[model samples]
Target: MARPRKPLLSRDRIVTTALALIDEEGLAALSTRRLAAELGVSGPSLYNHFATKEAILDAAADTVVGRVDLSMFRDGRDWRGALLAWGRSYRAALTEHPRLVPYLAVGPGLRPAGLRMADAVFGGMVEAGWPPAQATRIGALMRYFVTGSALGSFAAGFVGDAAAYDPADYPHLGQAHLLARHREQVDEGAFETGLRALVDGLALQYAELGAGKDDAQGGAKGAAAE
Candidate 1:
């Protein structure tokens, strides 16, 4: 007798398998037929789970971003430590699925899990005393830096990849790359150092804002004394 058929499929398994296929063969290698074949099912079977190819890709993107640990700083952890942890986790997840980086860069999907993860990170910053506006700006900057760096590093070796530009044409760019290389374990070191500096810069801004608030209060009291 033939072997028994497996149980029913779910969205998570489909997303996980899609991610794995992309990791093993790159994003260009993915397609509904390819995925179904790899999953031991017929092409039409995938349609029952995902309505279109874009939908599947979107789910894959969600799976990648969902791996980030945004709640690391929720328990009243130091603000700097929290931001650093967020940055590191973001970098690692994106690096693991470099081909998915483009989709991730477009921002998280409309899925509930995606929204919750973002709120958790931003909420942590607010709880640590960062105003919503400032927190939002700082978060965007950190993401740009981390994602941009990972994109460069992941494509560094592949020629004809438009993302890889020649440093010789840009002197300062060349110099910065040289300095980065000089640093110990440059890849990891650069991520941490850049994150700390970015966070520190934000802290300075917050301090100045606090001082301005104090000054205004003191001026108001002085005028009332007269």
Candidate 2:
């Protein structure tokens, strides 16, 4: 048989496969041997593209972060609206593969996509009149909020044992047993509530930044006229 023109594997294929493995069975399920079986190639071939398992994992994790929509950060859009939209998009990406939250929470590291996502958020806030320091903080704040939300289901925690919430010892949790059934509703509600609170609180600080600037300008003008 003649040799094929195209190779069977590529960097993107490796990354996509790694991501799927992590999504389905979690971070621990990913191994050179298993990934090779899934990819239908020799284990040594995996090393041809990625130097190590952690490097491949980082690439896969970065692929998830890259899925976030940054269009709202473009010119002419206000920060508040942009934040809400971005928050929804970000949450969507993270929630899809909850197991990868730990990898992402460790920071961007050397992942270009992750760094770009962070840059978009920080740059957009700075462009929207937020002080540089506060803009940095907003990036960190949203990251913490988003990653924490994706770590696990608050409702699922009470599952598997409805009777655990007894009337005498846990009277307040009488209805808590039903929480598992309403997992989606409760978790989504909590994420939105927290996201809104963060943006709303920042909006106040945003207004103050402007007010302080105006006050300083007025004082300077008055002094010049003296």
Model 1 RMSD in Å is: 4.9
Report lDDT (Cα) of residue 18, candidate 1. Answer: 91
lDDT of candidate 1 over 197-226, digit per residue (tens): 888987898789789889999999999998
Total backbone collisions for each predicted model: 0, 0
Regions more than 4 Å wrong, model 1? 1-5, 152-184
The local distance difference test score of model 1 is 0.77
lDDT for position 35 in model 2: 95
Cα RMSD, each candidate: 4.9, 1.5
Report the lDDT of model 2 for residue 174: 83
Q: Report how far off residue 26 is in candidate 2 (Å).
A: 1.7
The residue pairs that clash in candidate 2, if any, are none
Clashing pairs in 1: none
